[model samples]
Target: MDIKNVFQAKDVPEAINLLDQYGEAAKVIAGGTDIIIALRENHVKVSVLVDISSIKELKEIKTSDDWVEMGAAVTFTEVMDYFKGHKEYSGLIEAASLVGSPQIRNAATIGGNICNASPAADFVPPLLALDAVLTVEGKEGKREVRLEDFLLDKGRVDLNKGELLTTIKFIRLRKGQTVTFSKLGLRKALAISRLSTAVYLEIDDDEKCAEVRVASGSIGKHGLRERVAEESLKGKNLDKAAIDEASKVLSNEVEKRLAGRSSCEFKKDAVEGIFLKAVEKAMVHNGDGSYCAMGTQYYPRAAGKE
Candidate 1:
């Protein structure tokens, strides 16, 4: 790491000022899970590091009647703890809990996970499914951008030179609405996702799908909404046939998008199972306590990693 200066910011304003002063030469670091590796490998060139991990405002998790917001520095362990017993956030909990080993989860921040913009980022698919919004603050002002729009491409976001991603917000899951996530990895412990899917589902009084949003990871340049599959499920009963139809749509889209890649054949086939799992998990949350099959069973436990 060829870093010269490291600025420990106490708050958002201070962090922004540091970033404004250093511009492209400065990098905002919270967990250092990704950036540390990038800097060591010379993938990122920066002379100064602006640390925001200790900022109180960046570590807060706020909830309201209609929304849930989490600060940029909140770790995955923090996410698991705060939303542990809440069934509406089971998808988020599952994603956060499955990130790397426990030690890595303790240090990995949600903001870093999103900003790093890896195609296989676990939390991103779930956030995308929830239609989360990001708050970015800079010298100019604070502005909100939809999570999908904020992500420009792999390893890229809309954050400007002086801006920092402050918070991520999404509508609270109401009755009949839930989000679920599933991923295929080589092993259960410290396994990076080969493919993943997240489903946000709402079933109406008529037993029909009121709304459905599907997002996927590792099957594209970045986490992306499977809109065609979503369209297939909306307004239809979330029965075996509907889910199967949607899975087929998702698989076909994957095939088309990854036609020239060597992993295309495998991913196009593998995505069906992963998508099915995510949607089924979302549908099973019909007020039953059995919403999350894994219910707080964090991975990489004493039991062998499988």
Candidate 2:
């Protein structure tokens, strides 16, 4: 693939203008981590490259009273640094920390991860569990879409040829709410995830589950919410029995999704363990001592026990 032109935009408007001018003939490059490889392999044949990595506006991370907005170009290192030691959303920090190596983390942007739309993207499950929304910009204007909807399929997104992703936003988790992630990768570091789960749970004053959201990756076409599992856990005690039932629900969902594949049998059995691990981590962060040790009997603490 021979490059015809490389244009560097100074701001969002300029980037959108370049995209509009070139249409499908141009491609956007931020970190150049994924795009460069696509170009090398002839997967993407573009005559123009619009470089948005230098745009300061696209690299900002903003926090508000209700939500946090991360610019499209914000790197994984930036996100990890910003939320370091913040256990409420440690799932996101953990996922970001696991993306490739230190150099890759410094170069890979959250927007690029979402835009790539890989079935095994490390960041998708945690973001989905967080109910994140994406802000897309184009010549017409900017519009927002839920992260779940923005991902169309593997290697595909809702982004139009003349559009660029601007920001990702999600509501802040309040007290008694936490999201945690677990992944089974090919190796300890710099390995792609084979399967992963992210659990978001909120316990009420009575120690019953007030809200539950489960998202899984590398099991279906894209990262998806495990509604059946979530529904089963709602208003229920977060004890061993409830956790086991929820894990069974997730296993069934995975089996149904990958019925004919060779990996189905392995994944169906593995999902339960992974889901349980994610839930256990989430419970620990939420101050649940009953799940202090895995593979042990449940012992519910007295009321008001932290």
Candidate 3:
């Protein structure tokens, strides 16, 4: 990696101005967890590096009555700490905790993960399931973009030369709503996901599904919503049979999307278990006792228990 100049912007506006001045020659570095590797691998070349990790305004997390707003520079550790023991959003906390290891989590920013836009990024699916919106600031002005639309393709985003992602905001999970994540990786910890699922579900008093949002990573060109699977469960009672059917729907969707890829067969089968696990977790956290008895047999026991 060769860099002619390195500028540490003290604030968001200064960062935008620096980006505008350097144009495409400048690359933003927050935590440098992904950008450093890309630079060393020669995947990205730039004449200037603008470090925004020190910007205080970009590192805070705030919550309103309806939404939670996380600064672009907020670390995974910060996210984990904020949501610790909060069952409604446990899936997101789990995702953040599972990104890399302790050191990496301490340094990796949520904005960096989204901007990296890797198909296998662990955080993307959960955020997508939650319907996240991004606040991007540029020299011209500030604009908001949906997380799904901001991700254009593998390693590509909708951001322009002078823009900087400032914050990620999402609707807070409310009563009767639960979001959960399940990942199938090569190893238990610090492994890149082979297949993963995130589910957001809400059930009405009658036990019929009111809202369902399903998203997956490493099973498509980018992290995407599984509408077919979601449609299969919407307005239905999320029983074991319904979960099984939805899992199959997700598997078939994966098979169709990756028909000829070498990992298709494995992924097709793997997604069934992953999707079911995500749904089951979401149901368990639904807080209504609706699904408590549906799948209790499969729940993992405590460390000392049989």
Using lDDT as the measure, the top candidate is 1
Least accurate 10 contiguous residues by lDDT in model 1: 296-305
Candidate 1 residue-wise lDDT, 1-306, digit = tens = 889999999889999999999988999999999999999999999999999999999898999999999998999999999998888678899999989999999999999999999999999999999999999999999999999999899999998899999999999877667888999998999999999999998766555778888999998878999999999988986667778988999999999999999999999999999998887676444343222222212222311212
TM-score of each: 0.92, 0.93, 0.93
Question: What's the TM for model 2?
Answer: 0.93
Give the CA lDDT, 0 to 100, for residue 275 in model 1: 91
Give me the runs in candidate 2 sitting further than 4 Å from their true place. Answer: 285-303
Error of 1 at 72 (Å): 1.0
lDDT of 3 by residue, 173-251 (tens): 7766778899988887789888889998876655578888999999887899999999999988776778898888889
> Which is superior by TM-score, 1 or 2?
2
In terms of lDDT, the poorest run of 10 residues in model 2 is 290-299
Which residue ranges in model 3 land beyond 4 Å of their true spot? 285-306
Residue-by-residue lDDT tens digits, candidate 2, 108-180: 9998888988899989999999899999999889899999999898899999888999999988877677888
